[model samples]
Target: MWSAHHRRTAILGWLVFVVLATVVGGATGTVTASDDEMGTGDSARATKILDDAGIDEPASELVMVGAKSPDGWRDAAADLSRALDRTGRVTALKEPLPSKDGKEALLRFQIKGKSDDAADQVQPVLDAVDRAKDAGAEHGVTVHQFGDASSEKHLNDLLADDLKKAEFTAVPLALGILLVAFGAVVAALLPVGLALTACVAAFGLLSLASHQLHLFETTFSVMFLMGLAVGVDYCLFYLRRERDERAAGHDAETALRIAAATSGRAVLVSGLTVMVAMAGMFLSGLLLFKGFAIATILVVCVAMLGSVTVLPALLAWLGDRIDAGRIPFLNRRSRKGVHASGSVAGSLLKPVLAKPAFFAVAATALLLALAAPALGMKTEQLGLEKQFGSDAPLSVSFREITAEFPGGPEPALVVAKADDIRSAPARDALRELTRRAGKGAELTVHARQNVAEIAVPLPGSGTGAEAKKALAELRADVRDVRAGTGSAHGPALTAYVGGDLAESEDFTDQLGEGIVPVFLFIAAVTFLLMLVSFRSVVVAVTSIALNLLSVGAAYGVMTAVFQHGWGASLIGSEKVGAIENWMPLFVLVVLFGLSMDYHVFVVSRIREARDRGLGNADAIREGITRTAGAVTGAAVIMVAVFAVFGMLSMQDMQQMGVGLGVAVLLDATVVRMVLLPSLMSLLGERNWHTPRYLRWLPQVSHDEPAPAARPASPTWQHV
Candidate 1:
């Protein structure tokens, strides 16, 4: 596939595939989930009832006013009320309802359009509000506009700006790091070019995938960002290998062929591991996780394919020009001998190898310590109040509403669907339920033709303990009321709980239920793959252990920073007081797979040395000495990429960046460089042990040549 003569075919074919995917994706675009698409249980039922009733849930704009008199406030609010009515954007407008304290009042408008598409209707409403505010100021009244539509627009804009900043910042930073590592223009650009094409194609494929599934608007940005980093990483691994082989005096064809066999095979295995890990998130049974898992997996698969095929072909075409325009200080070592400065590897390995128990225990202890905070970790998805900055006027308005109104914007809705809500029996039951609920929370009950809704104002963010406690008591009271009504002979009333807090709790709890099983499944599959690939139970099992430690450590670190608020200000971290519900599971799956990239590469080299009849100790020494440069370079690049994402303002992305960056660094350096060698050294010959029953399995070979003529230096052996 990577034949030197086929360079043009490989390059041109890749270009064509990219173009077609992009065109197809553009034609199809993406299908995003609206509130109806995302909701479940009682919330979902409520949505259906409203839809069946042909009731459009109005996108409301709340105008709160503070002025000298109630009459004066009404007059000021009337300006916005009239402005909204005149703009013709609203289906209806309501008169100002003054608060118990004459200082504040509420005015509401039902904006035009489907609630999901209501952001478009916001601009005109905002324009009207702005004019109304100016008018209120003339009358010595202060007006602040807040609404569901206004909040959505602000969030949409914030996320867009965040992604744009990341794109502009991450690209140059990644390239600069690549330049520093490769120290040559062409060498650096090759990885970047290949990564970009892979991202374009991934986005194309993801667009098509979205229509079949529920994809959040944020999914593509995450895929593209991750694709860029991992794509470049795969290319970097293979390209570095090919360059090394070339420096060892192999021709371009031989170098690339060997890279295909070696780093190429590694990428496939690593990519499979990653995809399998990501696939586990599907079991969480959350549409959001499913979307991210699928999109990320697709992008990784595409990047790996490009690494193996297009990458080798490009190297063949570049030939000597791969090193064209090389930086001055970097080439001298390459011209003489490879930078196989196993010094960092050696310096760390020697003491650990000498005191295996001490180092092993010490390293494990450190990771476990980092992971300690994880035991106390709470998981809840952030609501708008937690997600948005306080600087936004909508956030300020929300605070005011919460201050003036008992429960803020979110109220627990008890929906009862009977054949006829107007029926005497149904009416009596609903009234009793509402009266019982009112004992614990402020309640308003309304009945339509067949459906009755009771709104209970339970304050604080829905995820908070206060809201949960209030909701629990309210539900218990409602159950008691319903049982007392004894509609046993009459039609049974269908009742459900629905609200923002209720939905958040449902999502969090459902995802939590699936996580344990998902973890076991992913772990089992990854272990089997490694065992099959390496033909050693010890290598596979140990790899899993190290990966778990790193992931655990990442969880601990993330929990500490975001949940415990340790050094939170450094990253501009939001104190969400819990890891995002999806984050821990997400980080576990992703980190487990990513941590394996270095583990497999380094351990495989050790196994290859052992195959050449080296002692267990000698093989360990030789393997670490041989691939130290490549492993560390790749690790540094990955860490840098993740750190860039951490620099963004979003809390969820911040948590992800911290987890990934810290874990990868720990996996590459401490786990691989220090603990692995120590543990293997202590275990000695047991490191390669596999059961006799496993001997019948088909043998898999990496880039090992058929008893090749020995190269000048052992550094160029399998490479």
Candidate 2:
């Protein structure tokens, strides 16, 4: 009777989501204004080149140069200068500067605009550079250009190109996974549609939030994609269950209520669990993780709302229509497999039950073995060039420059304050320190009345481990020098190192310290929630243990692939150094949430069967069989969506994609499919038993209380 009411509510909920998605999508175009502001790697490199060339301060005069024999290159440069003049942004460009590489050209220009958009005002100058390329080509010369304005223009274009590719791959892959999982075209489309709606709304909300808080550009796109994948996954569980119930002969309304009461409750708990897990990122004291945590929480909350409200409502409205186009080869004959009766899962579990002590010890041993590598897991910063693309021109050029100049690109800065720099003893000490630092390399010292700044050029090429080691040595030398400089300047001469390596080291250290506590907190919360939901100590403990095993194995795989350089060549990354600093926290939050989702679905069904008066063994067998197909299908879909990230050029995306895909696949198959059922079946009625005092807690039973006696089914009913 109450089932029909819930179905109507579910239909109405979906309608709301659709409306919200449409309104948000229509109001905002795909591109944002900030897209223009986020400059390219080329721009960063160009700025570094100019800075190194000692070009600073506002410029009114500029120059442009082209290849000597290339008439076409000279013409193109002239055209770009005219374009810049047309914009009324710059005063004029001087004739091309002499080309360092013979085939390339350079341009110097003057800024005329008072507007803050003066940087953007140089668009015409960029156009002229492009035009000059043709001239260089005609003369068998390549037109390579470098300048502040040209660099910015190049960066913007590159980012736009990469973004286009990412969108092209992520969307189609996500939709295709859904289609295969649901079988029916329309049914599969629903979750993707809902996920898109949530993501659009999240982007708008995040943009607005950014005005009041700090949010990185990368976070927005990554969170949106990840949130969509998870949201679709959440909806898939509920919708699949509802379909299964209807196929089993329950009316649409009854199926809706049953799904909502069971799967719906699971969705709510799972969503909250995911949110709680993500909140652990707050412990890192990093705005990046904090932003992600907040964004993820919002997306999960919206997804949960859709699962409970829209999913049920859609089921009621569609009725049997949800299963209209079943794929001939793929549709299950009977949503039952090995665990259908006291058959496969039950029989397999029976043996484990017969020797619980052995199986328990064996499983524990396996988990510990996989967990061993994690103890030695090292944390380090991924090189930006390596993250983007090892063979990219910027990366290649930077390497060349570093090799030629050594630590010229990356210098360790040592800043110290002293009571007085005029003292003969202090001057001597400083000179000696600088001489020692420069012994094996080039070191430059600058001193003021009360301060000294030392620039130490490290040995070997820059942008890799050797450069980092040199910086470390320089810091140690500075420390030794400070210690030896006695009481005259001792207290006031405190020194601190500040540079690329210092900042990166600080970030990595913070990330490592925060991961353990955050993981423990997430585990503790998951344990309490499971205990409260199922009222069984063993079940709660077993659930956490299984989740950890899956996570551990996933990390081990990452260690092998990313850290050990296994298959790295296939992926395009040259050096496999260390995992991303924050990947562990991100992986933990995501894995815990996903693992809990499956756990709740499987256990909830078992509890439903048990409530119908079936013994623990029979209920588990039935529960697992009924739910396994749907769980497996859903996991496959998720795995597919996550795997798409592996196609991206970005290293961070690859790590995230591989880590999540492996974890989900393992949890769904090995841990959930085999181990969970085996463990539960062995426990029997004890699996659902609660402690004496805890019996007072409210319990929602899925089955109606049975009459004292009933006729047994001919095939398998037992007295």
Candidate 3:
């Protein structure tokens, strides 16, 4: 439909689609998930029971003040409590609690609305904290604020600031790289412009979808990062091919057709493969994963459509003017295509073609070496201490509170329920649970009617290794309480552990259990896609292995940097000591899809040369050399976009951005440039082999003429 023959129709249709998507998305605002909706496993169940009892735990935060003088500390605590309650955004306020030594005190409160609404209502609470800080200073005390509402506000604000910074950083850097590659301002800007446009459209689509779904806050950034990287990459593939064909002396129409016939087909295949990998996230059985997959799939599909339909129309409209604003020396070099033959890729290909076995073994070994650290990679849900930004006020306050107070703000809430807790046996069970909790841990339990909420004070911000151990011991004793109770009710009542620690542990366990199925699904699907695309079993197997190697290396690098704190010093990150619970599944789905864009494009070019009667060695060199310039340019652009994500203050965003950027670098340089050629060079003619049983697979050509060895008949026509 976007063929040059329908130039005006294609151009107008694309413009309408982008505009319509945005308008519809704006009309229906996004709907965010509730706290219970965000949960999974034991933690989720505990939260649900709390909710059913009409309890609203407003993500309570605290303002802590410390002083040497007992009189000053008491005065500061009174002042802080009154100031917070006067804000009118809080539903309930608790009396200030003082430490035994009278050195510190904390005022706690629940926000007026639900947990999700707390972030939006934090302005009043913040203003109150500001007042407390000033009042504490005058009273000869120190004050700091940290809690659930404060965390939401700070993280949301930080992410918004980081995204704005990324735009200003990534776009200009990408344009400059494109200028160096294309040697013309107009030609270079096209890819970046197209990428930005696609992101806007993807945002529109996601916004519309959000009404029918429960969108997470992180989904927007994920879409932006993925949409921009893949959009530009697809555009670069098509534009480079069109220009190369034009440079080879073809007219405008002919160049576009050949570009569409080749790069366009690769985009379709690559986009489908990305969707397939994204589909694996649905197996996770977590709403967060499913939501992420839906949003990203929308972005990738929209970007793919633009690359095929609108990109061709834009090129057709530009004609000879695409290269109008050419740079002098660079233009001269580009005009003669110096990069296609005299590049480092060309030099590197020689050794691989000469001794395929040696290079193949060496490159494989290096990738595995990079992947070694992942074997010991630890997993955890980031605690408050781990999730906090270094400069966030709440983080500073949290540290102060932990140092000065016996029990900090964060504590584990263990909720247990029964029909009639006032009965003798039920009462004994509750008493026994409370008694057992106090044995080896600092704990307190409160009972009202049929329910009991046991508050376990977690020392050290309530998320350290010792805190977790205490929680485990408390849980072990709960079984004993269950055995002692509920005969009056005629059934044993069980307590569910839920809190920051429980949520993290449950999600990590979920990821661990579900990841194998997701991985196997992606591997099986990608291998089949490659098999169908290449019609060679060896090629399909090689693609799958290389992708695994690249993803494994990414995981290893992430573990070393984020888990082991290897790069924390250089990057100014607070040492997390564990990976984010969601990162491994997220990276796998995204990396597999993205890495395939380059793999399929280069492999298609190689197959074309082979079909054109070149020997395996010659075809490998020509195909890789011909496509190397564009592939490297696209890869660099992608890496640049991802690197900007590393600049964000959020730890999860940093981990993902750096991991993706590094993975792409590895895949393009080692896997694509070195390992691929070596493997193919070793296989020779076997690289193109197709079994008779698989002859029913459709033939998708890549701008290559029909082979003289085969009969002339139309197998497929879309490409």
> What is the TM-score of each predicted model, taking all chains together?
0.92, 0.74, 0.93
Model 3: per-residue Cα lDDT over 1-719, one tens digit each: 24454667887887788899899988888888776778898889888887887776667877777887774678767766777778888866777777677677777778888877898998988987787778667657788788888877888887788888888898898998888888898899898888888889888888888877788888888888888889889999999999888878876666787888889999999999998889899898888988899988998998898899888978877888898899998787665554554366788899988999999999999999989989988878775555666556667777777776644576767778877656666666767777776733333333563667777776666777877887777767776677666455465676777778777777888999989999999999999999999888888888888899999999998889888888766766756778888998999989989989999999999988887888888888888998988888889999998888876778888889888999999999999988999998888778788899988988767544322222232311211
Q: Which ranking of candidates, highest lDDT first?
A: 3, 1, 2
Alpha carbon lDDT at 224, candidate 2: 62
Q: Model 3's lDDT to the true fold?
A: 0.81
The prediction achieving the highest TM-score against the true structure is: 3
Clashes of 2: 18
Alpha-carbon RMSD of each model: 4.0, 8.4, 4.0
Q: Give the residue spans of candidate 1 off by over 4 A.
A: 1-5, 51-54, 67-75, 130-142, 329-341, 439-449, 461-463, 477-488, 707-719
Off by over 4 Å in 3: 69-71, 138-140, 333-342, 406-408, 421-425, 439-451, 479-494, 703-719
lDDT of 1 by residue, 350-383 (tens): 7777788998999999999999999999988776
- Cα lDDT tens digits, model 2, 1-719, are 12233555555555675566546645653333221122222222323332343433233323334354644356666666676667666665667644345433455566665322445766665556456556556765454433334434444455455556666776677677656665566777788877777776666556555554456546765666566677787788788777777767775555666677778888888888888988887776666677777778777877777777666656655666776776654335333331242255455555555665577666656656755666667666665555656576545544544443345344555555566755665676667667766754333333443555555666654435776776677668777887877785443354555444555665676677778888888888998888888888788888888888888977876676677776767755544567877787788878998788788888888888887788776687677777776677678767876676655666777777788888898888667656776677667667877889777766655552332332243311210
Against the correct fold, how does model 2 do in TM-score? Answer: 0.74
Give candidate 1's error at residue 57 in angstroms: 1.5
Q: Cα miss at 86, model 3 (Å)?
A: 2.9
TM-score computed on alpha carbons, candidate 3: 0.93
